[model samples]
Target: MAYCKYHPLTASTYHCESCQINQCDHCVDDDPEHPEPRCFVCAGAVDSLGATDIAPFWRRLDRAFHYPMNKQTMMLIFIASLLASLGAFIGGITGFCLSLIVTAITTKYSFLCLQRTTDGGVTAPDMNEAFSGGFKIILHIIFILIGISLMIVGVERLFGGLASVLFSIFWMVCLPAVFINYARFEQIGPAINPIEIGRLVFTLGGAYLLLLLFIAIMIASVGTLHQILEEQVYFFSAILQSIVSYYYLIVIFHLMGYLIFQKQKILGFTSRLESSEHSAGRSSQNRMLANIDVLTKEGQFDGACATFKQGLQAFPTSYELHSRFFDFLYGLNKLDEIDAFWPTYLDLVGRQGRENQASTAYQRLLLLDKHYQPTSPDVRYRIAQACFEAGKSVLVVKLLNGLHRDDPQYKALIPAYELMAKALDDLPNKREQAEKLRRMMRQLAHHST
Candidate 1:
């Protein structure tokens, strides 16, 4: 037994002959018969993409944040994954092929997602564009897996039981290695080469362990959820379980790509665009926006306005900055200014598709000042519902009453009545108000019909 190369304290089960690196059971490809593990250089042709150095996991974690939470990107991942699941359900080679195609699609978009965000842009990747390279991707995966399988089986036969267990651990950690290689090169040869795989792992060092650990935990969590659902055996539980598991898979895959992005230099990958910090600093619009933020937070309204105007000068098309400026003006009761820009502000907010935020803002506007009128009927409808859920009964009633006063034929009165009924039933204090509301609701229902 030897100490593992990565975890020095741990006992090593196998040694990689090519790289002369020692690894424990957790690091080698599991083949029960293999006499010894081979390093990535021999396993796959090493890319020598980056140095063996990687930034601290905690440090890289922050810079890696932008790519993870793009709802649009997430939706794409989910849809691709869902399609893959549907394919698998078809239960044949056809199904397998379809699933593989979707896998390639998601992988392509996943990498494109990283490039777009890490290189200083924040746009959602187009779904069609992301799904562009399906057939080539499937071929790459097929070649890699088939080639790697031979190496793995031969090694297992040479070493037998103990080496088999160790190989299993190696296989576990190699998944990301395989993905990163193919995603970067889009080729079967490098991705499947054991040497390249080993080199990538060796370069990742301890962060690789952390990545492995996170993946294990994520899989275990999803499995545990599936088990719990299985125990209940509900009619829809299987569907729910499948959805949760596939979603987790997409997240883990995204995480794998992000790891590569975080350690790009060591992995030999390069961004085609400028670094984020340099780009942000060079942008006059960004500087002015930052200045406006600081000035506004300090209550320097005049200074904030000056900074806001400065940002607008350079970024005339930036609806994001324009929206923020409108927020500032709205806060300061500069209605004249807000009204002047209402068309633009509304257009931007509408185009941005944050109707929920707009609705909430509308709610707050009406709740704070009774004189304000909502631009849409749905505003009062949603706001009152939100207020009820938050236990703002007074506000709910007030909003409902005002809407009713404004229009006796208000559209959402039924939902409002149902909510009030529930409130009256649940709260003893509100029960007294319930009867009157019920009577009015009945009267309104009768008259409307």
Candidate 2:
């Protein structure tokens, strides 16, 4: 599976064939006029991604190894392949079944990871996900293979025929496209249907041909290495050959899938590829925020809010809309408004690791201004933690005191004493007081048990 070249944790939402890199939704630029999004590095449409716009393919060939699939996961897969190979040597029903099942499981699992990566998630799938699409993934491949087998059987022996050669060439060229469709939709109908398959190939045009050429070379190279290893006649060499072969098979599969993701706009699959929210252009966002600021200074809070809401309606994923509105509300002491839109406040700085700012927002909601109050234990604990981190031990104590008064056995208050002790311990004359609070924390812990 291909992950975002920028953030390894996040899966890729789109492939910028222009910059020759994968990007998550946060990094992609969608201008609404195009179905496929261009990355921030590419200034124009996805179609404008020409050879001059990207790095050489040879330099970027190492990106398949740059996936989020960690060494431990790949190591586990290698070990599984080793076991399956050993089992196949037994030559019975058990061995045959194990070999087929292991191959199916590994391929399905790899495809699941690819799908998840393109969907903009971060984590590589665990082993159980290999069984998720289950027999369906294997079945699609089997169906296509069966069809090819039938075609070759019917035509290969016919009178030194041109038809046999033509069919063989057709199957070879269309095989990658067939698997690409199957991987995306999980249906044999989509894979084997000639019209559907042909449309995808033509829509993708030279790109599909280039991808096929690349896959052919990639597999031939890996397979040639495996052939040399097998000729070495060593057990360890054979095991390593299996590992290399299957590993590159999955890599080629991902390359094919990324081709689809990059060309999804023309293929009408952009809805699946695009993120849930479409972000507006930066200039459009700047203009919207500027107008909102004008309305706010003119004492039209409702108009400012309405304009902000409309802009967000148009561009739900606009970070500036969220953060600028948060700052505007904060500047006006609009505590109720800020509290109402707390999620936007959190999302504004989500990618920036702004825990201190989040704590500050919680402080404003819980303590800074007394107008708006949240009355949940979870809320209060969050407020106390944020206040503690903000270095407001007094407010932390006040919030904890309220919780303790309401429920004398409130175990969460123990952390309040812990925070208080840490803050006091840093001061010159407060060591004894800090120790006293530590004792109180211990007493609470002991009594709670």
Candidate 3:
């Protein structure tokens, strides 16, 4: 009874790998009778041949570490433990020194990955970029260590008890700051702030001070009471101890609850904002659609066309609605409708607007009647201009010929005729044709005079 390799839903089997239970034809690597079926999941052969296997040490190491699998997290924990042990064996001074460098490098690379992942997906940073960031963090740690050493030496040598007390305070503050700095650069955790460190110090210090004050008051009160009522004083002291213990526990639980609840609230708010943005986008699309219908009903064809266009931009696939609306506007012979819709219509057909639309409209006008023609000299000249712009010298020659024959009185075209003559001359394999065009232009020039 062979088990299915892909899905557990079906219970069927076949003699060949290609028709194996739960496996598609595409999933088969090779013919079963040729050698053996290779299990892609485990990289093992069902039918064995005495073939030597060669694989990279890194690949093996990767498999062992479970590179992309759930085991990768376990591998990271293992590495951290091993590194920490190595650090401890080297002594606190050496361990801290080396671990700082290692931590900085690892953290920096991880941070770059995190940043890229945040932007989109888990993009692998180039080795060079990773190394550069890692080195920068290493340099930062060196500077920090140098500064700390100088501070320590200066306080020890010059300042006395007061300096020692200040140094103690500084050490407590600096330890957390250093941890945060390393974490940020290495990308281990949240960014560090000197202000945050100061706040933590002040908060915890105040709490400790308050606790000591309360303890002192309790002791003093008990001592005073003991002389007057020794037996009653012991019971009062026991009660005071119990009350203090309970108060501390309540404060701890309250702090824990606040941290957990606030985190959940922040996550919920972020989700709601994302959903709201999607809803707003949908609402804007609906509003544009409504505006289109209103404008068309009012017989504001031009305004309606423009509004419909704006709606299309908001929702591109609203072409079915736009097409029906456009046909209604076209029936009115609205020239502005032609101007407004022609560009987008040409774009949808994947044709260049200025050249393709003009050429197309010109051809349609010529087809209406053999003698029917464009009234605008500027439109004719622009057609010739487009030909030249497209590097179609032959087309330019043809357009200029038509324009000259149609409107000889338009003196604005002579300069264009001359320019076309020059471009025809520069065209490959058409020097003789270009000379004929120039001669024809000269004859036209003579006839005009």
Candidate 4:
């Protein structure tokens, strides 16, 4: 007799080598044919073999590096990352400087790629050619530095200090212009413009200079005012810090605005170019455009609804699509659907506006069919109707009057007017107002007829 490791079910004994549990057959469920019975500990160890039997490390790395879902873009990112990491490993300070430069370059490249992708253009850049070009740039810089050093030491000594200074200033200006031209060449092609390259350089340089100037001013102000306002300096410092913070915030907002607006313009031009190419194959383009029209057409409301939903999935920031979808759903009498879409709709519209599409949709839903019943108007109007039905005539009349004043064409208010008349028909305090409403209803009916 051998004891079961897990439980004492019955005191019957069997030697189970698979689980290494000495137990009766009732206590151990062991496979008989290959029953060199693995113990519970051995079974647990066997389960861990699945995790260890994974693909080789290099194979996993290759998949991660080369076979990204966005293959072309990811390859560019991989190259950039490899370069950045290599640069960083050289030294901490060198790494930091290189990281900044690489980050800036990669960010610009990514923006260009995104712009091209959105415009339906091929955004693939030749990585080998790009690396070769970068090497050439490094070689050029080395040559320029060597030449400048030789000229400064040899020619400047012969010419004089004043002559050397003039020459240095001239070279400083010319160097920037030359580098700008080279950068333009690097970026410009059939898909990209030289002006765009120039603009990017100008924007980055200008932003950097502005940020430096702002920091200088903030430092100067704080240092200059510190001793003069010694007692109240802390309070003044707090105020100054807040102003500096807000100024930076404003600068950030300005940069974001410029980037968004500029990118839109650039992408628009690229889209136009793609569209021109598309137009060259007029019949095919027309067919494609016709298909798009069919999908988004007003007559095919269901398809339009689906297309709008798909567009929302793709471009969630597009308020225009949400507005169009809301209209489509409203037309289909999907009043309940309004709640699901309104939050997104209002966020898109923002705080200040006259023609708030979401609010209008909500108001329209409330005025549906003019009846104020379950299948008639929406919940808000139905609540008003319920008050009238429950003999809360004063509340009903007040709500209806407010609605009539705010939106005279609210269809539910017509029924509200009639209900108000009935609710106040014989009431001692409201007979005169009720009579006037009945007269007005009569006139409305006459005019409508």
Against the true structure, whose lDDT is highest? 2
TM-score of each: 0.44, 0.50, 0.26, 0.25
Residue by residue across 1-449, what tens digits does model 1's lDDT show? 34756667875544555666665433443232334223322442211112123345455544444444567656765666566667767859888877777777766666665445433233446767766776676676677777767767777899986776777667667977887777667667777777888998998787778888877887788788877787674535544655556455545555565566566666555432233223223344554564455346446688778777777666766877887887787788775565455455455555665434444554556554666654444555555565666666665565565455666666887777777576566665877787888888888888888
Candidate 1's TM-score: 0.44
- Considering TM-score, which of the candidate structures 1 and 3 is the better prediction for this target? 1
lDDT of 2 by residue, 136-225 (tens): 778768878897777676777774468878877877898888877776787778877767887878887887788778777867887788
RMSD of each: 22.2, 16.0, 27.3, 27.7
The sequence of per-residue lDDT tens digits that candidate 4 reaches over residues 189-276 is: 3112234434544554544344345445645765666555556645444444433333333232223222222333332321222322
Candidates arranged by TM-score, highest first:
2, 1, 3, 4
Candidate 3 has its poorest 10 consecutive residues by lDDT at 269-278
Candidate 4 has a TM-score of 0.25
lDDT for 80 in candidate 1 is 61
Name the candidate that leads on TM-score.
2
Error of model 3, residue 407, in angstroms: 45
**Which clashing pairs does model 3 show?**
107-186, 108-186
Provide the global lDDT of candidate 1 against the true structure: 0.61
Instruction: List the candidate 3 regions with Cα displacement exceeding 4 Å.
Output: 1-104, 109-136, 178-307, 310-449
Model 2 RMSD, rounded to 1 decimal: 16.0
The candidate 1 region of ten consecutive residues with least summed lDDT is 44-53
Off by over 4 Å in 4: 1-140, 147-170, 179-300, 307-327, 331-449
Count of backbone clashes for each model?
31, 0, 2, 5
